[model samples]
Target: MRDAVGRRTFLKRSAMGSAASLTPTGLLAVGAGQAQKPAAPSERVRVGLIGVGVRGRDHHLRFLGANPRVEIAAICDVDRSRADFAGQLALRGSKRRPLIFGDFRSLLDRKDIDAVVIATPDHWHSIIAIQAMEAGKDVYCEKPLTLFIAEGRRMVNVARQYGTVIQVGSQQRSDWHFRRAVALVRRQRIGRLKRIVTHLGNPGTTSGAFINPGVWEPVQTPPEGLDFNMWLGPAPYHEYSPNRCHFEFRYNLDHSGGRITDWGAHHNDIAQWALDMDASGPVRIEGKGGFNKAGPYDYANYLEVHYTYGNGIELVCENEHGNGVRFEGSDGWINVTRLRLDASSPEILTEPVSGQDIRAYDEKNKSEEIPGTDEHHNNWLDCIKSRQRCAADIETGHRSATVCHLGNIAMRLGRKLEWDPDKEQFVGDAGANILKDKPFRAPWRL
Candidate 1:
């Protein structure tokens, strides 16, 4: 996924997300539950991890195991072997071994799990996270936040009703370079914002598009330890195909929104943040895409999208701007990615941002320690104790995901559509509005 950070970055910041008020054996105070005192700074938050696949087992475990502020209380996965493997990792790192659950619901029911770290496939994100929040567990869910737009709204609603501290795993907010770039733009170092542009590489290579009309990937019986049906979760069942499971799932429209949601979850999120439109989004959208093949991998493989926010700032996300977010203003433009941050004039980036300027995150004094070095993950842990909002909170994630969703919707419709950001729906188009939510396979419901 776009969020996989190299191990070396952990020295400064690892992955990004949130934490919770948890029991020594359980969780902290949920919004709907009784009001409890804020956690003591030194109190360890008990954490349950769901989806011990690559992102969860490899990166999340690596970071959480190292953070002294958190205890890996339990792990859940539809795959028994995967669950057992991650349980061992948590056991090796902590003084106590974590409990393993074949089903995530069992883990959520535990009073000992103060917070849940969800790295499940896109289709399962909304269901698990909403349930976790309802169970009084705080959350740190990986990006794309939802399989679809409506799910994100429900996740946000639960967070509000329960006062759950849900953080989206959008770690770029924790990157110092990204933080600086955002602050510079907000400080108007680039002058009045005129346009924001972004480019994500072709979805085929980038999103692992394996199902083509000509090439067929055989569907076979699931591996011995995998609960294939459970793995499918709320999504409709397709016979087991290696091409459609785990890392390869993004290419499918049912499970993901291809590059529009994959990479857009990151850059478009940065776009939303830079534009200072975290709580709101654009009012109009139009885009075009190429879906030449009628294959198992159905989402667009290529596209360009344009959004007009109420303020008239134009945001263009296409395939040619290079892989980053660029802000073009009246005076100059600043382009930023996970790599170097550059501007039309070096003098623009050199401009100092004062206390009077917008601090995308409060990184001034506390930028080096506590929530500093490991800004993203530690920011969530710190907020868990302080009862503060995380850098990439649930609502923020929803709004950003909305940008990508709108673009994808525009591509499918191939028309200019009006969106009411306040209503979070299409102005008058029933067909486009229908696309906002998806149908569940069976017992699962949004």
Candidate 2:
């Protein structure tokens, strides 16, 4: 059985490799060869902005301001105010401002736009991404890549089918310090990796029970100039509750995967990258948690999940210490987060990347801390022009998101699950298998 499984994996990868060689997007080549020449700054790439809320605004400003090569050609948001605000921002220094629309499809219809940046809520990610790629635009969608495992697979398929360059928004993958940590582990500089612990901080509490009355009541009217229905998109119908929308959407299951996917997307991505598990994930997962009854949320507030890989590596995900990652190996252990990198052997942080040991994507062949700016958004823009895969490509994003979903599913089911990464199924666990995908409301199909 082991031999047969190995043969199957080999065949699948071989077929994928062959197909990738003929792809026009040129993703696989970057993975296989040395970094390509830098893209010319004078050659501009036109972009369309989708979902211009908080993240959308950030992308709009960075791409339009920082990247001289990018021009914001269109902006779309269900909220009229947001769309108008984005248009104003895009027109600040330009003679011709980008066209604005309340519907994303209208923006996609334009022929001048070359790519799209999707910064919408979690539930809207897959659908928007699928549509954009189908419309012949490269995509940079925020993570976790999909709301569920099945949607992620579909997104991957659609990107491949369109031969589009799709970069997932796991920004830590672009961080120089974080990439250094992964390099150290892969080089065995940390010795043989034994285990990994990812700390996700405390799962925030929802509204208190006593506050439920006020929280449950909808505002008298939808905010001025906002299209509530379009914002809701394919998510199940619900009254306009601020807590259930916008940034607060993270707490709900209908539109978000809770903190599991929120912080999990970032930490789990680094965990998977260091473990060299970009194409695959744990064979088994188990989790335990408690939920809050006083809130509209249906997901866990606190949880600890254990994932065991086929190669004997163990990854622990817990809502305990503040957000960070720790890698334990035979020689020592290293802990890294947005702020710091510390290890039993501090030398690991300073170790140089030798000629044979440098990562393929390390264009300058610079050491750990010396790579390009740690700004993930800028890195994606740089890669788009260079025709190189961004630090967090679709495959990397999918695997990390899969890990996050697996943890959530395990905690929700209160049972252990055996996963097949290639088949993307739960073996002999019918109950858990059901959580792999959720039913999309009518008119929305992956």
Candidate 3:
């Protein structure tokens, strides 16, 4: 039986660098080569939505709500009702009601749609985004850019090859406070950065044998209106259980990377962004955690991973404190989470950032007001129209997500590992490198 790791070699040999050569210029020529030709500023663009579950609904609300320059042209979901609900929402009080589909492929077939917002599960992000870009549509994918490190690199390569505006949904990068915090640190307001501590809180355990709810038993039967097989696309097939689907999917290793990837995709992303380590990542990762027995979920409930960068910056992910991020520097340390920012120097938080400090990081446009809005959704839309990169592009998202995944891998292996960002593999440990990618179910190639 062949594993996913072996397939990487096969893909690399067969493609022979074809995937890497698909540069922006080449992709533009293939898909929207003529997109550069100016059209009317008021010209409306159509969008298709894939995966209308929790985050997907939020995407629909934003795009269909205001944004007069774009329209929701289609919606797709494994759950029929969920897709219909989104379509209805888009149609409400509009001249055009978007078409609904159970399969994203059908939506991709429509030439009227110019882009897609993929809010699918972690495992499905890369494949769907790649296919959408190949089909000539821009993509706005939810954060943690890829399920695995290799997938992240592949997605980045594919996006560049297709010349599509791909945005990773790490909205905190767009937050005013977060960006300001990073800017201040980069500007040396905090002096030489020493160590950055990130707290993701505790994810706890998801063990103990528990049967499914009465309505969802019988093993063979799936819930009403839900297409379990479609939802499991690209992921190995498993028994349909509500606990393993939807939001709860994040707790499982096979489907998601638990809290490390779930919340880390958001908070750790800022840690990486603040450090200005978008293209590169930690050279070392070591994990310490325990797990629970029973159930298919196999991930660390509590983990503390230490990452070392070449610049002498140490990033620590601790599960002890509440969820937040802190940047420690020689002058002072600044901590910013979802709520507030705190520092040793009271002036750091309140003192108006000077023009000199802002110019140091080249963030002269940094505003006291919350930076960008709509959770970075509007940024993507505006970029699509202007033909510019989104705030959190694929490369940025991938690097941040890679940090989370690396932490999980180190924790699982219970040892330290050296990482090669350019090659995207573990240096000497073949066993560790094998975890870089995962096996896909048959007939669902990425």
Candidate 1 residues 1-446, lDDT tens each?
11143212321131233233311111111111111223332256789999989989987887886676677889999889989989888887567889999899999989867899999889999999989989988799999998778888888888877767677888877666666778888878888999998767633232222223223578899999899999897898889988788877888877888878888888889889988898999999999977647676777777789999999999998764457778899999998766667899989966566533465633353245222244577667655655567788888899988899999999999989999999899988999999888889999986
| Superposed Cα RMSD, model 1 | 8.5
- Candidate 2 per-residue lDDT over residues 1-446, each given as its tens digit: 21233322443454456444322222122221122222233345678888888877865554444454567788888888888987888887665678888888888888778789898899999988998989978788988898899888888887777656677888777665566677777788779999998888742221111111114555556798878877888888887877777776777888877777988999899889887788899999999966677666666777789999999999998875666788999999988776666888878877665434435234343332332333455455545544455667787898999999999999888888899998999999888888898887777776
Would you give me the overall lDDT of model 2? Answer: 0.74
- Collision pairs in model 2: none
Q: In model 3, what lDDT does residue 256 have? A: 85
- Residue lDDT tens for model 3, 275-294: 77878899998989656554
lDDT of all predictions, in order shown?
0.77, 0.74, 0.73
lDDT, candidate 3, equals 0.73
- How many clashes does the backbone of model 2 have? 0
Candidate 2 lDDT trough over 10 residues, lowest sum = 205-214
How does model 1 fare in lDDT?
A: 0.77
Q: Which residue runs does candidate 1 get wrong by more than 4 Å?
A: 1-42, 202-215, 292-294, 361-373
As a TM-score, model 1 comes out at 0.86
> Which pairs of residues collide in model 3?
22-161, 176-371
> Best by lDDT, which number?
1
